[model samples]
Target: MNKTILLTGVVFGLLAVVFGAFGAHGLEKMVEPEAISTFEIGVRYQMYHALFLLFIGLWTGLKANKKRIVYTLIVLGIALFSFSIYGLALNSIIKFDFRSIAFLTPIGGVFLIFGWFFTGYFILTQKRIN
Candidate 1:
């Protein structure tokens, strides 16, 4: 699970960079200003959580097996939040429809919040090095 999370984190991080570049260069002229802003928001969140996943991966390497599920939730939350924004931005850009999924983004945010909460709980519960 750790390896899977780490590998997925790496992939997501790389893809976020690609999408950011695509937004900057490929989408600059093709998308409206508002859509571009929306896409940038997606990219920002994606990059943030991708780094979170990377940190989870590092923690997994040093922690107990119980931590893997929390990391996976973090990754899943990132995917849901980032992809929904990307899809919505694209839909707006192309004049397609996808309002139904917008509500899911908050749910993803909830997952992300809980993932971090669990991480903090684990850290606090661990035996102190002192």
Candidate 2:
């Protein structure tokens, strides 16, 4: 599980860098300023979550179930929140508008927030440090 989370985090981080470059170079011309900004926001959040997962991977003293929940929520949350924005930002080229379900970004944010809460809970509940 630890290796999986770490590997996933690494992949996410690498992709964030790739997508950010794509947004800057490829998308800058194709999209308007506002769209580019939105795409940047997606990239920023994806990178942040990727780093967050890396931290979670190194963290210790958490129970297995709590770690699972946090990891799952964070992974899914990053996909939901970041991917929705990516789709919306690229709608002009992708020929698909995901705005109909734009509400997911916040829902995904809630999940990410809950993951932090769970991590904090685990830290507080644990007595011994390794």
Candidate 3:
């Protein structure tokens, strides 16, 4: 799980850098400032969840079965949440309808919320190792 998360993190990190650079340079001419902000919003969520997934993987190794659920939730959350944002941003760039995808963003947000609560619950409920 840790290695899986790490690999995905590397992928996301690379994409973020590329996309961020594109936004900073090329996108400026093609898109309005608000569109750029929206694109950056997607990139920001992707980067954050990518790191969070890595942390969950690391935590899985140090923790118990109960905590593994937390990792699962986070991974799933990132899949749903980050991927939606990426799709939305890409669609925007292509002149596709982004409004339709707006509904999905909140669903993704719910997953992240669940992931966070699951982690917190697992932490509070965990027994310390001697």
Candidate 4:
């Protein structure tokens, strides 16, 4: 599970960088400033969650089950939140209407919030810190 979390973190982090670069260069001329800004937000959140997963992978404070919960929530959050934003940002150029699924962004955000909350709750409730 730890290995899975670590690998996921690395993958997400790598993609964040790739996406960030694309947003800065390739997307600058293709999209409006507001779209670029929105895309950047997605990249930022993806990177943040990637680091969160990396830390969760290395930290021994949380049990396997707790780690799994966080992992699931975060993965889902990233998929729905960041990916949806990407689509929405590109909607102007793309044939598909990303606004159709715009509701997913906030739903994903809720999952991310829950993941963070659970992490803190689990750690706080633990009998030992170390």
Candidate 5:
């Protein structure tokens, strides 16, 4: 589970850097400043969650079942939150409608919030090794 989460985190981090650079360079010319800013936000959040997942992966004492749930939430959060923003940001260029799925961003945010909260709760409740 830990290694799986770690790999997921690495993938996300790599994509974040790629998207961030694309936003800073390629996107600026193709999209409006507002769109680029929005894309950048997606990149920022992706990077944040990526790091968070990485940390959680390394943190000790989590049982397998609990780890699965936490990792799932983080993964879904990235897929919904970050990817939705990426689509929204690129909508201008791609000319696709994202309004129907706009609600997903906040829902994804909620998942991420819950993920962190659960992680904290897990840490607090865990028996400390002497």
Candidate 6:
């Protein structure tokens, strides 16, 4: 599970960099300034979560099950939140209307908030050795 989390973090981080580059370069010519900003937001959040996952993977304070819960929430959050933003930002170029799924961005944000809250709660409650 730790390995999985770590690998996921690496993948997310790599993709974030790639997406960030695209947003900075290729995306500028294709999308409006506002759309580029939105795409940048998605990249920023993806990078943040990637780092979060990397930290979670290395931390030994949490049990496997607890880590799994955080992992699931974060993964789902990224999929729904960042990816949706990407789709919406690219709506001008893509065939589908990303606005149709705009509701998911907030939903995914909720998941991310819960994941962080749970992590803090679990850590605060954990018994520390003297």
Per-residue CA lDDT of candidate 1, range 30-89, in tens?
768788888888788788878877777766334646467687677778778878878887
Q: Residue 70 of candidate 3: its Cα lDDT?
A: 56
Which ranges in model 6 have alpha carbons more than 4 Å from their true place?
none
Candidates 1 and 3 compared by TM-score, better number: 1
Please report the candidate that would top lDDT against the real structure: 4
lDDT of 3 by residue, 10-128 (tens): 77777877877887888877767887777788778777877776676666434556545655666566666666665675664676676676777777778778878877776676685
Residue-wise lDDT of candidate 6 within 38-89, one digit each (tens)? Answer: 9999999999999999999999889999999999999999999999999999
How many steric clashes between backbone atoms does each model show?
0, 0, 0, 0, 0, 0
Worst 10 residues of 1 by lDDT: 58-67
Ranked by TM-score, the better of candidates 3 and 4 is 4
Error of 5 at 54 (Å): 1.1
**Please, what's the RMSD in Å of model 6?**
1.2
Of 2 and 4, which scores higher on TM-score? Answer: 4
Q: What is the TM-score of each candidate against the true structure?
A: 0.86, 0.93, 0.78, 0.98, 0.94, 0.97
Candidate 5: which stretches are off by over 4 Å?
none
Please write out the lDDT profile of model 4 over residues 1-130, one tens digit for every residue.
9999999999999999999999999998899999999999999999999999999999998899999999999999999999999999999999999999999999999999999999999988999976
Candidate no. 2 TM-score: 0.93
* lDDT comparison, 2 vs 3, better candidate: 2
Rank the models by lDDT, top first. 4, 6, 5, 2, 1, 3
Q: By the lDDT metric, which is better: model 2 or model 4? A: 4
Q: Let me know the TM-score candidate 6 reaches against the reference structure.
A: 0.97
Model 1: runs farther than 4 Å from truth? 60-64, 93-96, 128-130
Pitting candidate 4 against candidate 6, the one with the higher lDDT is: 4
